[model samples]
Target: MATLLLIEDDLMVRATLRQILERAGHVVIEADHGGEGLSKLEQQHIDLMITDIIMPEKEGIETIIEARRRHPQLPIMAISGGGRTRNMDFLEVARQAGADSTMAKPLRAQQLVDEIDQLLRA
Candidate 1:
């Protein structure tokens, strides 16, 4: 099983994702926001990262960029439910930044597992 990093600001979302990933047999490390996520990344050996965009402290796109610099081969999956204004497509921006994949929220747990499996295999 891969050690996956999950960075999301919403408590419910984070909990739900953790459950799903755990059920799929992944060892998930949680972070409430991008800054904390970055700290976790520095402290451990992460095989993959699943992050939400529009988060507090340090947005996901910025996290992806910085994490890429630190671990260039680390696979990242950027997820977003849009922003407050509903005008920003942050997922696209995340791709431009360095995310290996992007998914919209409310994520389908099976698809999420499949994607993670694919990333880990790659």
Candidate 2:
């Protein structure tokens, strides 16, 4: 099992994700925003990161870039419900910013775990 950093602004969504990850045997560390998530990353050993794209303090794109710069070997997964705006696709942006994988919100539990397993294996 991996120790994962789960960065999301929504309380309910974070809780749900925590439950899912914990049930799947991963230790979940939560952060309400990317800034906090980065802080946690600095203080601990995080095996993976699952971040929401449209967070408040620091958004996912910036977070992914900085995290990649700091921890080039760390695996990152970006997730969002609002994947696209008027002319931008945030998930695609996340990929360019250094996310190892991306998934839309309202994520399927099994698929989420499966993707995580693949990322961990890699």
Top-lDDT structure, candidate number: 2
Candidate 1 has which clashing residue pairs, if any? none
Please provide, for model 2 over 1-122, each residue's C-alpha lDDT reduced to its tens digit, 9 standing for 90 to 100: 89999999999999999999999999999999999999999999999999999989999999999999999999999999983463248889999999999998888999999999999999
Tell how far residue 106 is off in model 2, in angstroms. 0.7
Candidate 1 residues lying further than 4 Å off, grouped into runs, are none
* Segments of candidate 2 deviating more than 4 angstroms: 83-88
lDDT for model 1, on a 0 to 1 scale?
0.93
Write down the TM-score for model 2: 0.95
Which window of 10 residues has the lowest lDDT sum in candidate 1? 83-92
Q: All candidates' TM-scores?
A: 0.96, 0.95
Q: Global lDDT of each model?
A: 0.93, 0.94
Reference-based TM-score, model 1: 0.96
- Encode model 1's per-residue lDDT on 1-116: one tens digit a residue: 99999999999999999999999999999999999999999999999999999988998989999999999999999999897776448888999999999998878989999999
The predictions' CA RMSDs to the true structure, in order, are: 1.0, 1.6
